[model samples]
Target chain A: MELLKQRINKDGDIKEGNIVKVDSFLNHQIDVELLNEIGKEFKSRFSLEKIDKILTIEASGIAIAVIVAQYFNVPVVFAKKTDSKNLDKDTYESKVYSYTKDKTYTIRVSKKYLNKGENILILDDFLAKGKAAEGLIDIINQSNSNLIGVGIVIEKGFQNGGKNLRDKGIKLESLAIVDSIENGKIIFR
Target chain B: MELLKQRINKDGDIKEGNIVKVDSFLNHQIDVELLNEIGKEFKSRFSLEKIDKILTIEASGIAIAVIVAQYFNVPVVFAKKTDSKNLDKDTYESKVYSYTKDKTYTIRVSKKYLNKGENILILDDFLAKGKAAEGLIDIINQSNSNLIGVGIVIEKGFQNGGKNLRDKGIKLESLAIVDSIENGKIIFR
Candidate 1:
């Protein structure tokens, strides 16, 4: 976590409205070496949990989840943002509000992928408002699966998403927590 | 390669219109162990080449590309499917037509991640008509990056994408080539 924080400070760009851009290593352009370390961290934290599947949203979260799945020795199921021709007609769908995009989009996972009574570990790159995480949790609940825990690379501590999930008694572990961004500087908790 | 072909035959679904769905392993639900094998295979095939970076598209390709990047010890830059608020304005964009979706959409990659003269290896989950690969290649060319080769997990040999890229003198390696699917039987080349 210290390493992630250090890399974030060195490479991450702090934009207006407390936005942290970690494209250099975390999001846009991925650092596989760092991700493997993050995966090891996640594995160490939740290795005891009965995690049957690792779930994440498409685009960004897929990379982290796939790498982390290797540590957990589990299969990763990513929620598709759009209903593709190949996606199953019968899907567990939920709406995720993206503050950055200023809109809500439907996230879906096929019913065939999530079975009843399965233990799921949700992972993502960043947890801002927790809308995306909640949407993934919603899909899991709809499928009658158990939410083992949520693993995040970076959590915006100022945001309500992380707190809300913790308040609900859902097990949550964030590698790095950004408490606030003040005067174009990132403050870690 | 035989392992991949066997997994596909066991779990892959052959739907109407010659679609071979291997979402269980390649996409949707990703098997990291299998992906590790894939990554090693890709490394062995292109190990001699100087691949500076691994490039892929969002959603499906991100998982494979990230896992594959570990083998090349290179970073991965996935092309964003949409213009997000976080994505840089100055981007190398290209239009990709999805035969399955029956629509064309623009894919964008931040100019900062891809550098001129950098050798790039394009990785993808499936290569059908090769529209997606072509779109990625266009983005690479726009950024002045040299494409070392293309590594495809499954290439629809019946389709023209592989042929087209080969005709263009591009180095291409496909783990499994599906020649045809007849009466729910997948024929591999």
Candidate 2:
């Protein structure tokens, strides 16, 4: 976590509307080395839980979840944002509102992927409003699978997403939590 | 490669319109172990080339590229399909026509990631019409980067994608090239 926080402070770009762009290393262009460390840290944090599979949302979370899954030795199932013809007809669906894009989109996973009573760990790159996390959780619940915990690379502490998940008694582990971004300076919690 | 072929023969769903769905292990629900093998095979195939970075398109390609990057010990940079505000203003863009989506979309990579003269290896999950690969190649050219080769997990050999890339003198390494799907039977070349 210290390494991730340091990397964020060094490379993360702060923009208007509290957007912390770690595109240089985290999301857009990825650092596999850093992701491997993140994987190790998450494994250590959730070592006690029984994680059958890792679930995430598409576009960005796929990289983080796939890399982190290496340590857990588990398969990863990503919820697709679009209704592609390739996707299965029977799926567990949830609606997510993206403040960045200013639209609500449906995220779905094939019903064949998530089975009942399977232990699942949800992972993602950023946790801001918790809409994406909530959507993934909804899909997990619908599948009748057990939600082990949520692992996030970066969390906006000023936002309510992290707090909301914690309130639901979800074991949320955020590697780096930015308490605030003031005048281009990122304050970590 | 044998393992991948066996996986496809066993779990790949042959749907109408010549669609071979490997969502059971490749894209939607990912088998990290199989992906690791894929990484090793790619590394072995492109072992002689000096790969500075792994470039791929977003969504499914991210998982394969990241896992493959482990073997190469390099970073992975994915092109964004949508024009998100999070992406940089200055980008290397190219248009790709998706037959499945029945539309042409622009894929963008930031100017910072793909440096001029850097060696890049493009990796992806599927290579059908080669439009996606062509788009990525165009971005690489715009950035003045060197494209060492393109690695595909499954190449529809019956399609023109593989032939087109090879015709241009590009090193194309497809793990399993499916010659044709004959009455739900996948014949690999």
Candidate 3:
């Protein structure tokens, strides 16, 4: 976690409206080496839980989930943001409101992929308002799967997403939590 | 490659309009173990070349590219399908037409990630018409990057995408080439 926090400080871009862009190494262009480290850290953090599968929302989360899944020795199921013809007709769906895009989109996972009573750990890159995380959790619940925890690479602590999930007693582990940004400098918790 | 072919035969769903859905292991729901095998196979296929970075598109390709990057010990850079504020203004862009969606969309990669003269290997989940692969190649060319080759997990040999890339003298390696599907059976080349 310390390593991730340091990397964020060194490479993360602090912008207005609490936008922390770690795209240089985290999202757009990925650092597989660092992702492996993140995998190990998540493994250590969730060593006790029975994680049958890792679930994530597509685009950025796919990279982190797939890498982290290597350590867990579990398969990953990503919720597709768009309705593609390739996707299964029978799916568990949830609506996510993306503030960045200023619109709502549906995220879905095939009913065949997620089964009942399976222990699931949700992993993602950023946790801002928790809309995406909430959407994933909703799908997991609909499938009657057990929620083990949520592991995030970077959490915007300034936002209420982390607090709300914690309040609901969800086991949320964020490697780096940026509490605030001042003069284009990231302040981590 | 035999393992991948076997997986496709066992779990791949052959639908109308020449759709082969291997979402169980390759894309939607991912088997990390199988992906590691894919990574090893790609490394062996492109063993003679010097791969500086692995380039791919978002959603499904991110998972494969990240896993494949481990074998090459290189970073993976994925082109963004949708424009997000997180992406840089300076980018290499290319337009791709999607037959499934019946629309064309732009894919962009940050100018910072892809450098001139860098050797890039484009990896993707599927190659039907090769529109996505062509778009990626265009971006690589715009950046003045050297495209080492294009690697596809499954190439619809019935389509002309594979032929076109091969005709262009590109080192395109498709682990499993489906020549045709007959009576709900996949014929591999």
**lDDT, candidates in the order shown:** 0.93, 0.94, 0.94
TM-score of chain B of each: 0.98, 0.98, 0.98
The i-RMS of every model, in angstroms, reads 0.8, 0.8, 0.8
Looking at candidate 2 chain B, the ten consecutive residues that score lowest on lDDT are B81-90
Model 2 chain A worst lDDT run, 10 consecutive residues: A11-20
lDDT of 2 by residue, A1-189 (tens): 899989988898888887889999888899999999999999999999999999999989999999999999999999999888798889999999998778899999999999999999999999998999999999999999999999999999999999999998999999999999888899999
Where does model 1 exceed 4 Å of error?
none
What are the candidates' individual DockQ scores?
0.89, 0.86, 0.88
Candidate maximizing DockQ? 1
Report the Cα lDDT for residue B173, model 3: 99
- The superposed Cα distance between candidate 2 and the true structure at residue B10, in angstroms, equals 1.1
TM for candidate 1 is 0.98
Where does the lowest 10-residue lDDT sum fall in candidate 1 chain B?
B80-89
Better of 1 and 2 by DockQ: 1
Model 2, B57-155: lDDT tens per residue? Answer: 988999999999999999999999987878899999999998877888999999999999999999999998899999999999999999999999999
| lDDT accuracy of residue B95 in candidate 2 | 95
Candidate 1: give the clashing pairs: none
